[model samples]
Target: MLTVSIWIASSFMGLALLLNLYRLLRGPDIPDRIVALDTAYVNALSLLVLFGIQQGSRAYFEIALLMGMVGFVGTAMLAKYLLRGDIIE
Candidate 1:
């Protein structure tokens, strides 16, 4: 039952990933691309958590946490750059 749920979640995540990838590739505006990238990172994070649970590996969770932090920082910095044209004031 748990395995089935994980598989179903993973499948939906995969579909979301594809859609986000398309947006990232074909977005008409910079903000749209940024949003797509953020979504991709979030979906990737969820997938990592699910994979960690499936594999019973604490390391995967640690990595996922790190990725989430990095993704958040990166997105913030990118947004700052887009808004102010500079990452650092």
Candidate 2:
């Protein structure tokens, strides 16, 4: 059933999110932490979209889209800062 599938998918995504959180906390290097953070953002986005599908809500989808855009920008800024030691040059 659709409900069962959504539950299973969400469970996997949740597990992945947890692992990403662990990596973000324990990463050995800045780049590793950045990658983990970006992956965590993606996993969170997937979870949000899955929840939206399960709830049959349009608002959740819009929120997820906005989050996705913000996440991308945040990741980009972090990478830029890592490379140049400043976000704005």
Candidate 3:
């Protein structure tokens, strides 16, 4: 059933988010942590979209889109900072 599939998918995404959190906290280097953070956001977005599908609402999808945009910007800023020691040149 579609409901069952959504539940399974959401569980997997939750697990992925947890793993990403662990990596973000335990990463040995800045780059690794940054990557983890980015992945976490993506997983979170997936979870939100799945939730939206389950609830049959468009609000969660919109929120997920906004989160994705913010996540991208955050990741870019982190990468830039890592390379130049500052986000803004």
For all candidates, the clash counts are 0, 0, 0
Over 1-89, each residue of candidate 3 has an lDDT whose tens digit, in order, gives: 99999999999999999999999999999999999999999999999999999999999999999999999999999999999999876
TM-score of each: 0.97, 0.98, 0.97
Alpha-carbon deviation at 56 in model 2, angstroms: 0.4
Q: Per-residue alpha-carbon lDDT of model 1 for 1-89, expressed as tens digits?
A: 99999999999999999999999999999999999999999999999999999999999999999999999999999999998999987
Poorest stretch of ten by lDDT in candidate 2: 80-89
Question: Which residue pairs show collisions in model 3?
Answer: none
lDDT (Cα) of model 1: 0.96
Report the C-alpha displacement of residue 22, candidate 1, in angstroms. 0.5
Q: What is the lDDT of every predicted structure here?
A: 0.96, 0.97, 0.95
Q: Write the per-residue lDDT of candidate 2 for residues 1-89, one digit (tens) a residue.
A: 99999999999999999999999999999999999999999999999999999999999999999999999999999999999999987
Q: Each prediction's Cα RMSD?
A: 0.6, 0.5, 0.6
